[model samples]
Target: MEITDLTPAERRVWEAFPRGDGVDFREHPEDSSVDGAGWGPERTVRAEVLRALLLGAGRAEEGRVAGLKIKGARIVGSLDLRYAVVDHAIRLRDCWFERKPLMYGAQLKALVLGYSTLPGLTAATVRVDVVLRLSCCRITGPVRLQGAKLSALFLQGAVIGPTAGEESDEPPLQLNHVEVGTDIIANDLTVHGQLRLNGATVGGQVSLDRARLLAPGGIALHAETLTVGTDLRAHRMEAHGMVNLTGSRIPGQLNFAYAVFVNPDGVALRASSCAIGEMWLRNCPPVQGLVNLRRSQFDLLHVPAATWPEKIRIDGLSYRTLAPHLPAQERLPALEREESGYLPYAYEQLAGAYRTAGDEAAARTVQLAKLRRHRRTLPRHGRAWGLLQDVTVGYGFRPLRAAGWLLALLLVGSVAYGLHAPRPLKAGEAPDFNAVFYTIDLMLPIIGFGQESAYAPAGWYQWLSYLLIVTGWVLATTTAAGVSRSLQRQ
Candidate 1:
């Protein structure tokens, strides 16, 4: 087939493709206005001509290392290359497209549409040998790349969303089940709809640093079961809706430092059952809604103090270590915010972490707080028993309180027995009527010091002896129980 009848603009690109050279049609950068509004046909290139050049249509005389690189052209018509095998790299910079570039199931070296304006993209299942970049491009519709394989996918500083008054039922950026070799760097990406990354697997990192997801009161970023070999950094990213990462496995760190997730009506972050290594939720504002970390496991969890939101679901959430190594007092408040009601496992998990850190005192504090929270849901009699245990034994967390109770009881008995004298049963035969010894004998159950047997208390003093005996038995039982618990914990 003879390659003739090419327009002056098309001829320039055709001539440059053989030498892997590029053709620039614009007088200045972005010389073609957005959407190619008011652009003349002189700077236009048909998609068919560009596609023909990319498919090895160039003459054999002009030859080696051929690629297609064009800039600042108004591309008319759909650039469809579905299922075609193109062996050249195609890069169109600062260009305007009349329609979405279609590359579904196509095999290519690279497809870079940097700083271009297009409706959207449909490159699902396409395999790109090198990077597939749409950096700083303004896309007006959804971009789907489900099950695609790429070395890298860079959408840095891109604005991908629907046009004004366009209904956003579908996600604007879809990378479902994508297998990327290196990374998906989308820093400073602005999307007006959800960014779906369901089941995507990345070999390296996935950075959404400073990205703005503006889907308010909806699912902003849904990445369920996403597997990242390394870190998933979303530092300072802003999401006006929920960021759901349920069941995702990020072996490397999931760093969300300074990121703001706002979804007041529902869950702000639903990261249930995720297997994460070191999650940093540091130095951010209070999450607007419930943060669901249910059944999730983390190697390390880093959070700032007093920034916990009012609602949380942390049942079955386990972490090995906490950064900043805060005491139980600082971290216990987060457990209290569980919206689904108090879970003893949450407290136990916290207490165990403190114990692992060799902070027995902090562990006891956490256990004490757990008892208090548990006591609220008890029956009337159960609550009364709990109150007695708390006041006298500090729920086994404060064993010193039990000693204090014993001292107070002993003081009361001593004062009562000192003021009153009990007549001796045997005249001049019994030991001397020592008030302290007799009081000790009366209060201590099953331990006779011979003073009680020698003396006979008449009138109200006898009744006081009985009262002291009962009080002593109760105190001894409670103290024994509390001490047994303390020993077991040790």
Candidate 2:
């Protein structure tokens, strides 16, 4: 691509290219009056000029393009570099584009479009060896990076949405299936539409710190099935709609501390089936919607006990450790804070988690709380019976409770039998009427001491013996069940 092959606008841009020693486009000029100072006089360049530059860079004798700098210029027409391979950086600072640059399937070293305003950007299937920086830029239309492979993507302080008075139906940013070798930093970004990163893979961290996303009545950030090699840090992030991270696999920590989510009638954070390292939701603002963590697994969970949403779903969540430790009295109530309050397994799962963490006392407290809540769910008339069963046998959690009840019943039966002694049923029946022995014989339904058959209870003592027999059977069955559960947990 020679100067003769360039269009009139391209020819002017080529003529204006700063030629001479010590001219670097990679570094911003210090002098404000310079041509490439980034805030200097605006220059209009045709898309053909950019294509010729890339071609010239590819065919350079040294195999390196020194600098391709264009500042404060309005790039006319769509700059299509699809499949064009270049080995140098392209820097466009404080420039405006009439249309989005199409870089689909292009291979480049690096791209810097900082402080620029563009209609949109399309880099699907494009591969960059280094960073792609769009910091402080304003995009009017969607910014698509689907299937792109880059080292890092920096959009810090960028504004992605429809321009004023323009209506957009598409998402603000789409990174679906994109793979980044390093990080994706979008700190302080303001996105008006959904920011979709579904199926994306990041080798390093995905930091959206202090980002503000607004897509009311819809999803604000959808990163389902995303795989992040390192931490996914979203501290102080403010999202107006649902932020779905379902099925994501994060090998490092997921920190969302001090984040604010506001989807009143829908899910605020849906991380179902996700496998994350440490999870931090501590000090976050009260979420208006549900935080679904069903089937998710994490090493540690740090969440505010009282600030959780009323409709949290933690059916199969398994966290090895929890932070901000509260006493059992406080922890048990926190587990029952869910609206509808019918999740028995949720309590069991928490208890199991506590037991796994070597907190048996806390686990037992959780189990007791579960039994109390379960009793409350019974019918009004059946509540008393359920409470009795729970207190006497811990609803099959405390086998010792059955033993205590059995001893009390045995003592009462013995005292009654002693007061009114049994009489012999037959002549010279060996008077097998020791009060303690008679009581024991009645209590043990299967193995009798031969006293119950040899003697008969007088007056109301017979009814007392019948009560003791029924109580013994109930206690025995409950004790067996409780022991089985304890063994299984161990």
Candidate 3:
């Protein structure tokens, strides 16, 4: 606290604190700094000096227009200001800190540590008026900002947590229950541990485009129950662990295009119960685990055919429209990836989408696919009946097949009876033998032409007549049953 005890470098910072003048020691730190140790006296500033300056030690009233701005210096010792209220901006860019700053429950104007190297940050429940910018910082420990309220949080290109393979129990970066006013942008950010944002309420968008979240065999991003006012963009992000967004509410687009996931936990992305707007999984690489999107609702889904993961739990995913508008055949394959087993509503949802697009044929195709899947779960007799309907009339989806069967049967009956004509009944009085009309009447089951009634066939010919009648009735019954079932489904 004595002026005579202060070093030459510390004395300069002490004299300039009141005016808030920025102190740039030199073009670079005096010497090659090593964790606030190897730096010469020129660039090494004691944390007590900064704390004294921030606490208004030697402040002057005349030139009190600025905050504290120190660049390229190595701050040694703890800048401990726990629960203190300070109305000044702290900009320590391109600096090295020996010990992490402790600002728990402190109220500050701003804290910008751009391009600095710090052990970690712990500012739980802190209130900042302006912003918290840690852009391009290399933090070696967990950065906890839980329950903090700030205007904006910009972590662009920052690298947090330990180096790869040094896994820790604590999450590397956590902003859980934090409230941001504008946006929380973290593009190109890399975290070696789980990045948690559970219960975060963001007024604007939260962009994490091209961020590398690496926490192997564990959760990479745990942002459940989040409330985002706008978009939550994570375009092209490569996550090594499970990204769980179980119950988020993002009214804007939730984009994950061109992203790659490699989680060994059997599940990659879990976004169930999310009421999101447009969601994009387009152009992304094949995921290694199941993407659980159960009970999620989206206005417009932008999952192209190529981006669908091989396994999914899409039991209750409802989307109004699909991007690229592929036909049902091309899109139905995605529904097959649902590992939660047969779900009729999922098929109906797809069919409804096609119907809304005015593609009834495609809709029918989806319905048929659904029935085929249903067939696998049916009993042996039911499956046999389903197979018959499928082969004969495509479960009433292809009525032309029924017509073709009728035509082929009529021709076979006509050929058999013509080659072995039945003996005439009431000789000289019976109607003339018309092979086509007689075969048609026999197959018709109800309508009777005079030829079939007036003639009598003995032995094998009589058996053939009975066969034609039974075949006609079976075809008609199966066609009617299949058509009725199809209509019932619709």
Candidate 4:
């Protein structure tokens, strides 16, 4: 479009473009002469004229619109670029917009809106070949990017909040189902509402380091079903509500080290069913609520035992390895910190995981730890029974304890019968009894050697006979149970 044919607002934008030189606006003078005509802050443009200028520039060579920069201008209306394909990069710095720009289904090379102020942005299904930057900008309403595709999204140091006079609670930034070729860096961002990225697929990392999100009593970050090819780094993130990443798949690590979560009565972090390569929550700020990791799988876990929240739900959660090699004393206590006393199956699962990783010593430690915690839950008198099971049979893991008791009992009985021999009851009964044979009869409950009927016991011997009978029954029952348990485990 020729300058003469353009509208007054369009003419101003046309005049703002540099002639042939590829100098960026950042290097240009604040009050540089435009098209031999001097322009100032008073040069406001309508959104329609800006759109037309972009369309005209798209038809030109790639660098023809390289320095097509706009600054200190107030856009009068919504800049609707729906379905428009622009080839060159667009940069709008220090600009103000009356309403949010609508870029639904639009295609662009790159978009930069640094130090700009807008009510919001709606770029649903829009595609950007290069970076989509909103650095140091102020967004007042929801920045919706549902189904959009971009190389990277940079919102570093941006301030996002609710629109003026709006009190309804909703997400301030939504990237639902969006696909990014690279990272989404939002470090130092101050978000007043929830930042929802549900179903988004990121080829690279999603870094929200040092970001502060505020959505009290609700979800501060919701990334359910998100697929991240690399790490989700949110180190030092301060969330006022739950940070939910339920069912997400992260091929790389999920790092949340030193992050602060403040949802005292509810779930502070929920990653149920997630599959993360590794997880780092070591030295995290005190979480006031529960951190639920039910059914999640991680290759490695780095969490301090003392830093565990007041409540945690780890039912079915398994990690292939644990960092720093927490001893059973520390590990079991952490698992016991759950509000619901103790979960025996959780301990079993962890021990099984350890065994699968070729850490049998750790597995046995965990198994014994589970037994100890379980003993605490039993009644005072029942705890003694449990202790006996542990010491004698190792909670059915050591069947040889029953055999040891039986052998010891047989020895004691042999010595007692040898010390005081019994006499035959009938005159015709020839005494064919020895100390060992007589003791065997008393020790084996199901078998008989005719010793108890044929030979008569004295006062002390009679009591000893009764003691041996009771010991035989106890050992036999325990041994049977232990053997059955070992078989079942196999």
Each candidate: RMSD to true structure? 1.8, 5.0, 2.2, 5.5
**Shift in Å, residue 251, candidate 1:** 0.8
Give Cα-based local distance difference scores for all models.
0.87, 0.80, 0.87, 0.79
lDDT (Cα, 0-100) at 453 in candidate 4: 66
> Candidate 4 lDDT, tens digit per residue, 73-187?
6666789998998765777766677779999999998898877788889999999999899987888888889999999999988888875466545678889899999999999
2 or 3, greater by TM-score: 3
Q: Tell me the tens digit of each residue's lDDT in model 1 across 1-490.
A: 2457778788888888888888987887636437474567877988999888777686434437888888888999889999999988899988999989999999999999988999989999999999999899999988989999999999999999987788867899999899999999999999989999999999999999999998888999999999999999999999999999999999998999999989989889889999999899888888888889999999988877655678888888999887768978889888878888889999988888888888889989998898889999999998888888888788777778877876776787678778878899999999988888787788785788899899988898889888878777877777787778878877
- Candidate 2 accuracy as TM-score: 0.79
Give the best candidate by TM-score: 1
Best by lDDT: 1
TM-score of 3: 0.94
Q: How do the predictions measure up, each by TM-score?
A: 0.96, 0.79, 0.94, 0.78
Find the 10 residues in a row with the least total lDDT in model 1: 29-38
Q: Per-residue lDDT tens digits of candidate 3, residues 1-490?
A: 8778788888777777678877886554542223445567888888888887777775556746657888778888999878988787888887889999999999999999988889989899999999999998989888989999999999999999987657667998989999999999999999998999999999999999999998878899999999999999999999998999999999999999898888855689999999999888888887878789899998888877877678889888898887868978788888888897788989988888888788888989998999899999999999998998888888888889999998998898789888988898788998889888888888885788777888888898788789888878877888898889877866
Worst 10 residues of 3 by lDDT: 28-37
- Candidates 1 and 3 compared by TM-score, better number: 1
Q: Note the residue pairs that clash in candidate 4.
A: none
Q: What is the lDDT of residue 298 in candidate 2?
A: 93
Whose lDDT is higher: candidate 1's or candidate 2's?
A: 1
Ranking by lDDT: 1, 3, 2, 4
